[model samples]
Target: MGGAMAVRVAAAGHTLTVFNRTRAAAEAVATRCPVDVTVAGTAREAAAAADVVVVSLADDAAARATYGGSDGLVAGLAAGAVVADTSTVAPETTRALEADVRSAGGLLADTPVSGSVSSVEGGTVLVMAGGSAEAVERAAPALESFAQRIIHLGPLGSGATMKLAVNAMVFGLNQTLAEALVLAEKSGVARELAYEVIANSAVAAPFVHYKRAAFEHPESAPVAFALDLVAKDLDLATALATQVGAPVPQVELNRRIVGDAIAAGRGAEDLSALAEHLRG
Candidate 1:
């Protein structure tokens, strides 16, 4: 998604300074970008070069790592820079980082995104941004290069909270779809046929449309979103529910199913692999 976002931003005619955990991965993204892309050696270097810095990482730990330390992004941020973090992390994490960035003379926004890699490449992803109005506005140009829809959702950490909520629904839908598909197959309906009807049915979602290949042909479909990542997201979501004293029975069940799949060594598979797990 970071690579795709880089390409999309470059396609929009913005020069970028790209940095990844791996230097080679950053170089690869630079090669794919249409506009000039400087591959930065460190997160700090990348942050120093841009008015708006976009950080896309795996989780809260990665986000914290990339933004801390002597050579981290916070150390090299240009004063008054707007840093938009696109990682799906705990709201607490985002709010903590926001303070660090603030003290460094920069603003930070939790700008979690929604949509697949293809949607990112096509510049159709949705961005849910949370920050002060000034900060969100400053980050909009960078986010708009890749996101067709960008919503400013109040102060810091709002995007992270909303992302957790959205993902809870997503995981629930995935679980239900897997169960429904397995039930259909056991009742003699073809997997492909069942998926087709589901994709067109009243319950059809954007995810159902894009996940067709993975659900119908798991063996060949690429791992767009891995089951391990799904498990991680569920973990964050369920944790947030507990923190807020909310009863999320269905999300807990989804988390357990994902945990079981991971325990069975299917963690690296696509989320759609749940159907196969359920079939067993």
Candidate 2:
């Protein structure tokens, strides 16, 4: 996701400095960007050199490691700089990071996004940003360059919480669709035919159409969104629901299904693989 954004930013005539845990990956991204992209040695160095530092990591541990380490991004940020994170994590985690950046005289916002890789590349993703109005405004230009719709949702953690909500519904819907598809196949319908019908059906979401190929042939499904990542997102969503007074029965059930799918060695596969697993 970071790599895609960097390319888009570079294409938009913005000077982007990029950093990756793997030096070679960063170098590779730099070469592919249409415009020149400077590669920074570390997150700290990248933050130090830029006024607006954007980070999108895998999870809470990776995020904390990058932003809390001795030579972390937060430590090197300039005063009044805006540091934004696009990871989908617990709301409290975002608040904590917000406090850390604010204490260091920088602004922090949680800006989780929605849409597939194609949408991201097309710069048509919806960005749910959470922070003060001032901070959201400060990050608008960069966000606008990559996002077609940007919603500044209230304060810190709000964006992440909303993202968690969105994710729960989406992944749960996919899992339910997987079950329905499997049922259809077992009830004397061809999987391919079933997928075509669903893709054109009234209830079909854009995501369903996007994953039609994967749903029909899970064996070689492209890993646009991996099973493990969505599983982790579901776990976060479940935790949030439990914390709040919401009874998400479907989310809990879908969480177990995703866990089973991951345990069945489909962790690295596209989440549409869940249909294959369910059919099994």
Candidate 3:
């Protein structure tokens, strides 16, 4: 996802520099773009070179690691720089990171995005941005590089909150769709035909349209969103729900189903593989 976003940013004529824990991964991103992308050895080096730095790490832990150390991105940031963090983490994590960036004379926006690789490639992902209007506006050009739409939710961690809400729906839909598909198959309905009806029905969301190949041929389709990541997102969602005194019983159930699939060693499979997990 990070690599795809880099390609989109570069395609938008932004001067881009990439840094990944794995040098080869950074190199791969550079190779994908026709423009010159400087491959930096450290997060600090990359952050120092840009006024607006967009971060897309794996999770909260990775986000902390990239922004916390003495030679971190915050340390290398020029004064008044804007940092857009696109990782899906708890609101608390973003709040803490925002403080760190603010202390360093920089602005941080919790700009978690919603979309898959195709959306990134096409520069059509939805960005849920949370920050002061000034900070979010400062980061708009870079965010606009890869986002089709950007919604400024509110201050601090609002983007994370909205992202979790969106994922809660996505995960619940995934589980219900899996069950519906498996139920149809077991009840003598053809798998493809059932999917056809589902896709054409009122529930034919963008996720369903893009995920058709994965659901129809779980074994052959590339993993768009891994189950392990889905579990992680579910954990964030449930934790947020608890923090705000909200009830997410459906997400809680989806978490258990995802946990069971992970325990069975299908953690690395696509989320659509939930259908196969249910078939067994």
Question: Candidate 3 lDDT, tens digit per residue, 107-177?
Answer: 99999999888988888899999999998999999889889999999998999999999999999888989
Determine which window of 10 residues in candidate 2 has minimal summed lDDT: 213-222
Backbone N/Cα/C clashes per model: 0, 0, 0
56-135: candidate 1 lDDT, tens digit per residue: 99888899999999879999999999999989999999999988998999999999998989989888899998999999
Residue 124 CA displacement from its true place in model 3, Å: 1.4
Using lDDT as the measure, the top candidate is: 3
State the lDDT of candidate 2 residue by residue for 106-204, as single tens digits.
Answer: 999889898877777899989999999888888877877789998999988999999999988889779878988999999999988988888888869
Q: After superposition, which runs of candidate 2 have C-alpha atoms over 4 Å from their true positions?
A: none
Could you give me the TM-score of model 1 versus the true structure? Answer: 0.98
Off by over 4 Å in 3: none
For each candidate, the alpha-carbon lDDT, in order, equals: 0.91, 0.85, 0.92
Which segments of model 1 are wrong by more than 4 Å?
none
What C-alpha lDDT, on a 0 to 100 scale, does residue 213 get in candidate 3? 87
